[model samples]
Target: MKVWFALILCWQLLAPAFANEAVPLADDPVVEQRLITIAEELRCLVCQNESLAGSRAELANDLRREVRSLITAGKSDAEIKEFLVSRYGDFVLYKPPVKPSTWLLWFGPLLLLLGAVWLLIRTIRQTQNNANTEVLDDTKRARAQALLQNTDLPK
Candidate 1:
């Protein structure tokens, strides 16, 4: 009983060391809010689907720290954004400005979706047309009906 109790106590003491701890964020609410706003607008390079604010990746943490320093340095939001964009390119921004180079990113998925719809419609129509053309002739229809009805007529 004492051994079991000791083991249980050790497990309880050691469990937290293996668990994730929340990161320490900026102390001031305004600074924290600014960090969040900036982070939300930026995409995590390592987690392409998640915004930096929501990503748990190490790179995201580093980027947040960079943003915190920038805030502490009294840089305007636009200036901070510009510095990040210059360093990481437009891919870092969740909503990049529309430009000649970024036109594909803005419109490519819509074009692909429309193309898919057209192809689906065309395929469905072609299948219907083929089905219409495959109707059994009179003799074959008679044979099929006779077979269905269990007639013993020789083929």
Candidate 2:
């Protein structure tokens, strides 16, 4: 029983160490650096908010492998990026080119914010106009006074 317990404790301690091994890749420092740079600029499709370098999703892993392969093939960084863009569309790029195709993606939020501001201004102006229009004329003022006086009388 003591031997079994010792084995279990030893396994538990070493399990996490095994799990932490980095994925094997090419040993060329320049190629590795290029891969890292490209990966940082690419968005992880499966994890929309994370860069490919930061995501652990299967798709991210696959993309990292693809980048490593391209680097090993001696592709220029621009060529690698073009290949990824062709395959995955502009969404794959963290800072996509400002072009006709991506105009909405880049400017839609600003347009919506401006529209909201316009609507708020219009609403406030309309409310102010309505409040100003509710001012009582002399006849309506006398009528309101009479009504108040009548309401005060015993029913």
Candidate 3:
């Protein structure tokens, strides 16, 4: 039992180190760091809301390898990004370029927010108008009161 407890504790302690290990990049620390930074700024096409560097998907791993190769080949960051953009289009970038092709992607949320606000305002106004229309006038209120007072007509 003591040996099993010790093994469990040891595994628990070492588990985090294994968890944090990413796909291996180039041996050069500088190039590896740059590659990681670039990869972290790219979205993984196979995973929603996960950066390429953070995603464990096979496609993300392939993209990381591609980035490492580009860095090893002495490609500047901009050149590497341009190459990726040319091949994959703007969707791979976490921060896609502001261009005609991407205007909807860039501005869609704001437009949706504005449209929702407009709809909410219109709904509220319509609800208020409906409430006003449904309210009983003075004559109707008096008639209702008379009906209540004449309750002897029905059980």
Better of 2 and 3 by TM-score: 2
**Distance from true position, residue 85, model 2, in Å?**
0.9
Question: Candidate 1 clashing pairs?
Answer: none
* Tens-place lDDT digits, model 3, residues 1-155: 99999999999999998774656657899988998899888999899599988899988888889999999998999999999989988898999989999999999999999999999999999999998889787877877887989753322
Candidate 2 C-alpha lDDT tens digits along 1-155: 99999999999999998774567766898887888888999999999999998898888888899899988998999999999999999999999999999999899999999999999999999999999889897877877887888854322
TM-score of each predicted structure versus truth? 0.71, 0.75, 0.72
Worst 10 residues of 3 by lDDT: 146-155
Cα error, residue 90 of model 1, in Å, equals: 1.9
Candidate that would win on TM-score: 2
Candidate 2 global TM-score: 0.75
Over 4 Å off, model 1: 1-8, 16-22, 135-138, 141-155
Candidate 1, residue 76: CA error in Å?
1.7
Each prediction's whole-model lDDT (CA): 0.94, 0.90, 0.88
Q: RMSD of candidate 3 to the true fold?
A: 5.6
Highest-scoring model, lDDT = 1
